[model samples]
Target: MISSVLVANRGEIARRVFRTARRMGIATVAVYSEADADAPHVAEADQAVLIGPAAARESYLVADKIIAAARATGAEAIHPGYGFLSENAAFAEAVIAAGLVWIGPPPAAILAMGLKDAAKALMIEAGVPVTPGYLGEDQSLARLQAEADAIGYPVLIKAVAGGGGKGMRKVDAAAGFAEALASCQREAAASFGDDKVLIEKYVTRPRHIEVQIFGDAHGEVVHLFERDCSLQRRHQKVIEEAPAPGMSAEARAAVTSAAVKAAKAVNYRGAGTVEFIADASEGLRPDRIWFMEMNTRLQVEHPVTEAVTGVDLVEWQFRVASGEPLPLRQDEITLNGHALEARLYAENPAGGFLPSIGVLEHFRMPAGIRVDSAVEEGDEVSPHYDPMIAKLIAHAPTREGASDRLAQACAEVEVWPVKTNAGFLARCLDHADFIAGDVDTGFIGARLDALAATPEPSDEALMVAAAAALGDQDGPATPWRDLTGFRLNAAPETTLRLYLDGRPVLASLPQGDVEADVLITGDEVIVFEAGEAYAFSARAPIADLDEAAGDGQIRSPMPGKVVAVSVSVGDTVTRGQVLMTLEAMKMEHGLTAPFDGEVEALLVSAGDQVSEGVSLARLKAAA
Candidate 1:
């Protein structure tokens, strides 16, 4: 048995592994970068080590540093908790070379399933069904275009080494194939150091279903059911649950058996997920599902599996890595209640889903659920990392009950300053289609506008903010006496001027005890409702003298580096034309012209680091 373990990752995954390690009476180690010096995972570990700088390449992705840190801390084993080096075959080899137990699959298995093209070929050979695609060795532009033409329109260009929605794009026609291919290759080169790509037939009305499979060194593999990650936005999963809705026993058996077969083919060990794409146009059927790719590590949505299976997956990893057999036989494992997990990201959904970076002044998760988080109140959400703040999971005896409980939990979220997607997630959970279990990967993209729309604060919320503003005023010793201009004969109404998102709004609050949860921070009165925090200020709005009709100042939406400056001064541009692209929070945001105009000034160039609100260009109306 391993006495000490080092988690070669950060954020919630690191804390997750540490929790399981501590419960098993094992010592835990944590490795962090300068940016994460004060991260909760570091403080929670028995031993901590500084690996490198903030950028992931210099820190978390540097496998040598990870192994050296584990050695320095006397860690007997290394648990790569997904991302970074988790699926790096060479990294796994290096860990074993350094006499450290690797809490994952063997290097051969990782390499076997590392690239999408190779993995698909192997799956097809192993009798596991795969999506129809071109998995050739040719990497020329003409060759890929020809393949796309052969595969027909609506083809998908995927980075052979891609994961997490990066380095992937869907082209609906041949006219857009070249541009999408270039963009996909660029992202692939940057993210995976490999520009090689493959073409696949894009599945219309697709539902992402993946089976959780575990194997042991003793040559046994068992699946822990399947998860439906159909609720997605821009190909990134938002909400996930198990077992997939509308999944019949025949479909489940086919997918799960295929997953186990895939694992056995590679002699896989430990926890791995075999992802599949199902054509949901006619509901789930065994023949309609085909293999997508394999994620050879613990998934972000593994908590839902744990909640349903009553299994400690991390503990299983430790035991399996210690040369143990399977913990339970295939017939012994069983699924319990339905579980749902929503990823709470620090982002503004209505504002193009831009990542929000700042100190989390107020952070509170809903009660009566499982919350796996890394940051706490007052922690800074750095732009150098993923924007996800936490994962909230809820389980109930039935799917409807679980959905209602999870929706309520999301609605009860309380976060301030750092914007979160709690309201957006709650909206998705409560959507009529979602309630009826009619979901697919396109669910969120189709309803983004309605789901991400900024909600109008209820009259009750306005009243609470108004009361909080009155309470902040001086000369009021108690809430009863704080109501200024209160008239006992006129229903004791007090009118106050408040600013909502910099726009002035008039609100009236009753004199009697106003019941609402409100926080008065600095000059802002924040009211929480339906998982949204509305900040209202009693202070008057400031006038911007430079602001005028049809103003065209192109500003950075968030702190990031300019990737491509597409315009020059004096260039005439039309409304919706791309001005430049900003890379921030691991995603690119394109700055576009607000109206037809001439580029008056170019303030920044490509590769220049910029802060939020920094003006990049200026446009003047065309003559």
Candidate 2:
């Protein structure tokens, strides 16, 4: 058995690995950068080492620093948790070369499945079904365009080295192919340093279902089952669940068996996920499913698989890394119940899902559920890393029951100041199509406007906020009674002025206590409803409010670099015209004109880093 383990990652990834290490009675080592010096994972580890500065290039991605930390701490092995150096074949090889066990698959297997184009060819040879596509060596734009025409319209151009939805584009027709190809290649080079791409037929209605397969050094491979990660936005998964909702017995058998075969083809060891894209224009069928790519590490959604199978995947990884034989035969793994996992990110769904960065002044997750979190109350959500603060998982005897529980859990979340996607996740889980298992990768995008719109505070919430802003009542007397003056029950109908999200509103309370959880932080009164936070402060209505409007000031929504400037000063633009594009938190956001106006000033240029609320451009109202 491995005596000590060092996790070469940060945030919840490291924390999760440390948890299992402790339970197994093995010592845990944590390596952190300066930005994560006070992180929970660092404090919980048996030994900690500082690797580098805040930038990931200088810290987590530096394999030499990680190896040195492992040696200095007398660590027996290194576990590359999900991201950063987790899938880096060179880093895995380096760990082995330094006389420390590498708790992952062999370097050769990683390279075999690292590129999507090459992996598909290998899977085909292994008798696993793969999606029809063009994976030739030609890098010419004309060649890619020709391939798309042959593949038919609505082709998906994906980076051969891409994952996590980056470096991919969908072209609906021949006219859009060239521009989409350029954008795809640019993103591919920037993200992966590999500009090569492959074109495939894009299923109009695609469901992302992946099989979790595990292997041992003895060449035994078994699958745990399948997970539906179809609920996504912009190619990124938001919610995931196991045993796919509408998967037939035959479909499940086929997908899981193919996954095991793919693993065997690479002589794979430890945890790996074989992702398959299902054409769901009709429904999930064995013939409609095809292999897309393979993730050569433990997936973030592995908890749902564990919940259904009653198996500890981390423990299995440890056993396999120690050169042990398979822990369980193919028949030993049984799917029992249903489980759902929602990523709780520090982001504002209403504000175009922009990443929210701030100190978590008030953070609370619902009780009686599995929560893997990185930050606690008072911890800052820095802009230097992924904005996902935690993952909320729920399990029940049935799929419907699991969905209901997970929705309730999202609604009960209470985080403030720093926004989160809890409300959006709750809405998604409660959506009618989602409940009926009629979902696909385009589900969120199709209904983004509805799901991202911030709901108005309910009357009950308004009353609660009003009462809290009024302060304590005199000796058990209802706060509503005091607001209407000390008059003797004269049909108390006094309206008070309050600001909700900086907008003034007239509020009145009923005679009794409002049934809602309220948090009073400083002068701000916050109320949580359906997983949404409404902050209110009592104050006089602002005069000349229109002066602030129609100013034509385009401010940066969050801290990021200005990737492109599409308009110049004195240019006339219509409302909603994209003026510039800002790259933040690994996503591009287009800043648009709020109204039809002429550009009066361009305050910033391309490549300039801007902070949140900084005015990047301004316009003059059209005469």
- Per-candidate TM-scores read 0.96, 0.94
Query: Worst ten-residue run, lDDT, model 1?
Result: 479-488
- What overall lDDT goes with each candidate model? 0.91, 0.88
lDDT of 2 by residue, 1-623 (tens): 89999999989989999899999998999999999999999999999999999878789889999999999999999999987888889999999999999999999999999899999999999999888889999979889889999989899999998888888988999998987787778777766678889999999999999999999988788999999999988788899999998999999989988998999999999999999999998899999999999999999999999999999899999989988887899888898889999999989999888899988877889998999999888899887788899999999999999999999999999887799999999999999999998999999999999998888988877877776666542333231122222112222445778898668898886565445567765556678888899988775446554446667788898888887798999999999998998877666678999889899999999889999989999998889
Q: Candidate 1 on 1-623: residue-level lDDT in tens?
A: 89999999999999999999999999999999999999999999999999999999899999999999999989999999988899999999999999999999999999999999999999999999998889999989999999999998899999999898888999999998987898788778877899999999999899999999999989899999999999988778999999899999999999999999999999999999999999999999999999999999999999999999999999899999999998999999998989999999999999889999998877889999999997998789999888998999999999999999999999999887889999999999999999999999999989989999979998878887887787677633331122223222223587889999889898997766566667766677778899998989888878775564557788888888887787888999999988988888777777899989899999999889999898899999887
| Candidate 1 displacement at residue 105 in angstroms | 0.7
Prediction 1 TM-score vs. true: 0.96
- True-structure lDDT of candidate 1: 0.91
- The C-alpha stretches of model 1 lying farther than 4 A from their native spots are 475-491, 549-551, 568-570
Q: Give the TM-score of candidate 2.
A: 0.94
